[model samples]
Target: MTDTPSKYLLNVDYGVGGVTTHFRSRPLGDDLHSETMVLNLGPAHPATHGTVRIVVELSGETILDADVEVGYLHRGFEKMCETVDYNQVMPYADRLNYVSPIINNVGWCLTVESLLGIE
Candidate 1:
């Protein structure tokens, strides 16, 4: 019934008494809206975003949100392990990370050990 710059966009009501709103978008100064930019980082190994990606939304120097998208980084690791005995699976789990062989292997062992409810 009343138009207040952002009158209805408030909890009072949608345009009932609050102002308009965008799910995103910030104020640049006093009267201008901040521009939003999306930066995609990671999953850069083969140029495919289907594995894992970090999406960052930036407004000036402020970060609105940073999301980690895991599409298929370890899609079939479990399935791959399913076909082999636990002893043979260390190598497959090793495939998870080559940069830190010991840590990755230890993590895999810990994960499997925990799953089996053992120490």
Candidate 2:
């Protein structure tokens, strides 16, 4: 329905298509239709400490489509901060990013300090 074929075909904003609408493979042959396979990368063990699900569709060696779903790392950060005292939130923010957690902790502390009119 959109200007791009893949957007309407794959439902992923001009990416790739699937089964009945595999535009690329259709041009390869008419007698044999290429079967698409879906591969799940992860909902855990991500490079960044958070959990993420990566879905990839493949037609042989070529990638037909893909989708990425992001998770919250089960921290419930906002709610947790709300229930705790202002000083208690520093530790939680420090754990947000493993590679450079101190940055997050400092940023969170500064934000809370600003809100309380503390220089």
Candidate 3:
């Protein structure tokens, strides 16, 4: 008569000294689950001030991980920039970072001037 090992036991015959060890077939329970909470900050949250959506995983209100989704603001700027002259690209750049138009304007001007060897 032979004894059948439980499914969780690993049957290993080392030839000289055979041994069987029980192992967990499932992942260990997460201790983080008790310490953390998941939060969705914004698709339409007022503090975000825009259409940006962020999934934040927090450990007691401190952000542990964040996933940001920005597709709603996509204007195909890269595709548009590919079709335009250097001078024409500034306005689109202005639209992209509306809060700081002068910086975008100056940077675009400097870039165009550099390309033409004017500065």
lDDT on C-alpha atoms for all candidate structures: 0.69, 0.73, 0.72
* Backbone clashes under 3 angstroms, per model: 10, 0, 0
Evaluated against the true structure, the overall lDDT of model 1 is 0.69
- Ranked by TM-score from best down, the candidates are 2, 3, 1
9-63 in candidate 1: lDDT tens per residue?
A: 4555444436642235546576355377777677664665346677778888899
lDDT of model 2, residue 43 = 73
Per-model TM values vs. the true structure: 0.51, 0.58, 0.56
Q: Could you tell which candidate, 1 or 3, scores higher by lDDT? A: 3
Candidates sorted by lDDT, best first: 2, 3, 1
If both were scored by lDDT, which would come out higher, candidate 2 or candidate 3?
A: 2
lDDT of 3 by residue, 2-51 (tens): 67644433546424335542221334476535767667776778787557
Please provide, for model 2 over 1-119, each residue's C-alpha lDDT reduced to its tens digit, 9 standing for 90 to 100: 65645536555565543534222333446535647766777677555356777777888888878777776357789899999998999888988887899999889889888999999
Off by over 4 Å in 2: 1-35, 46-49
Task: Give candidate 1's TM-score.
Answer: 0.51
